[model samples]
Target: MSGMDPSAVPGPTVVDRRRLVFGVLPAAALLAAGCGRSNDDRSDGGRSARPPLALVYNGPQGCPACPETVAALLRGAPRPYRVEYVGGETPLTAAALADARLYVQPGGGADLKGTWRHLEGSAGAIRNWVREGGGFLGLCFGAYLAGRNPGFDLLPGDTNGYIDSPGATVTDGRDTVVPVNWQGRPRHMYFQDGPAFFLDPGADATVLATYPNKTAAVVVAPYGKGRVGVSGPHPEADASWYADKDLSNPDGVHFDLAYELIEATAGRR
Candidate 1:
């Protein structure tokens, strides 16, 4: 091993890792020495990196795993993403509702559990945005929020079950797990006030998981020119949510599916 030590590599050596990993790399002659960031293929010639995403969460209901999700995204997201809590704020305030490339909705717990009140005004803009090639993702309540037909009428449907306003308590069956993938497989969800999942004809929703009652646990569909995703379970619930006032019990499968749908639908491009 008298050759160059692997650690001595400098900046801007490899162009694309995929090109190197697959063993189909171009001639080594084209490859530069050392490894680092490059200015080519960048907008400003690498003057600076792309900005982090600004994600807004409407409603007063807070997500326990919100922080974790943001951390995970910042750590691993292909692009940067920032999280913000937007309660009582109009959707039109941000470009996301008007013309975002990808939009993600985190679990707003009870804030979005009302009579579709918060989104009543921005429904049309939301639909238009999706139909215009903007990606939409709904996690737990986020899915429910995106499924609302609102102004666009792109998706027409409603979430089943009835409960009081933000702090109403609904008793759970303790062992009554409405499995997302299949019955008997319990996904831990707590403090939920009867958020039964359902799908309507207008929604054109696809089922990724469900409860024994046949309600759609997870659904995905295309509306107009955009794609929408819904999750009945709270895959965003991380270890903190599980230990604290957890909503849906943290199920590995649910999180994987949520993350997958989120990336597919609302990834920052």
Candidate 2:
């Protein structure tokens, strides 16, 4: 978290609890400890450990749950991951993403234009990166931003087309718990007014999951040599999210799904 500022996103919700839960432990440390962060992992290895997967964290949209997203990825990732936070003065650049294997756009509540502005000229870089076999994961707002916007248009054929963006794809600003049919079972997950993919005819995207309305809740599309996956709900929601929403998952079925999502995005790598 040294190179990133979790508090940069101005809002009442953007809290930095990453340090509290993670402390001096790096991502790999948390993994060795167990599914939950434990003090035992601290003595396992030095902080110089570098995982095979490299991720870029896009933080310009002022995502309050950005840190939580990172925590979930670290806890559930199939392989070791290294994250590079991109935003503020340190704009997301082609050079930065050159060596990264995956890029994650965390959930946030901010104007698309303003959020997209952070990567003004970096869209092509991102597109090219993924097109060359890199991976991209968009969560909630990140999924919405990936649709065709005023910027580079990472995911085209979106129903909104940058006009009334988020257009008929979502229930305008509505945040609530919703049921998602994943694989083949129903899973209750946290849904903020996230984009339900309405791909145009002949769209190359593949539906990974669907909402009750049959609208795409999660999708993976091929862009040249790379692949991009977007999810309309927060599978990585932490305990605080469930507590505030008065929701419970005794079996932790939803939590395990987060790892599945990550594996799907990581693809064969």
Give the residue spans of candidate 1 off by over 4 A. Answer: 1-54, 62-91, 94-99, 111-118, 147-156, 162-178, 182-191, 194-196, 201-203, 245-254, 267-269
lDDT of 1 by residue, 63-130 (tens): 33343353354334444344443434544433555434556565433333232455566566666677
What TM value does model 1 have? Answer: 0.57
- For model 2, state the Cα shift of residue 135 in Å: 0.6
Candidate 2, 9-82: lDDT as tens digits: 22112111122122433332111100111111112135465664555454655444464455455534556565
For each candidate in turn, the TM-score is 0.57, 0.73
